[model samples]
Target: MVVDEQFRLHPESTAYLDAVRGMGRSVNTERNYAYGLALYLTWCDERAFSWSDPGFENLLRLRNWLVSTPLPVRGRRVQPVIRYRKDG
Candidate 1:
């Protein structure tokens, strides 16, 4: 389920995930969707847009930001994943 930094369950996200799960999606699918929702909500929060109803322009901006920005480097203790990004 999606959660904030404080570790509380996100109500809307949890409900959505539950619905998807009830439809027979796998736990892996739930995890992936949860991650994506967290990213979208966090982006909306940073830009002071209402997460549920960000406007079309705001959504376009989010799309642009996602393509332009590099993904974060994630690592395990034994190995790290390296991603290369191209700049416009």
Candidate 2:
């Protein structure tokens, strides 16, 4: 089991990560989830928001930020665009 410093500081997050591993999830999947959670915590810290109890508005803001944030890949960066469709 790999222990990340940030996860150590956030016990709840560490427990969640441990649960993910206990579920027989792949190491890569676990790592990805950990990285994602770390990013969320960082975002919350930047805004002095409570990561454990983020309100709906804050969640929406986080979603918007995620959409606009570019991810690095293969020495290049790519921004993910999400499109919503209206359906009956």
- Specify the highest-lDDT model's number: 1
**Lowest lDDT 10-mer window, candidate 2?**
79-88
**Pairs of residues at least 3 apart in sequence or in different chains that clash in candidate 1:** none
lDDT of 1 by residue, 1-88 (tens): 5456778887988899989999999989989898889889889989888988999999889888887777777766465565644543
lDDT of 2 by residue, 1-88 (tens): 2234554467788889999999999999999999888888889988998988999999988888777765544433375454432222
Q: What Cα-based lDDT does every candidate model obtain?
A: 0.82, 0.77
Q: Provide C-alpha RMSD values for all models, in order.
A: 3.5, 5.4
Off by over 4 Å in 1: 74-88
Q: Model 2 scores what on Cα lDDT?
A: 0.77
Against the true structure, whose TM-score is highest? 1
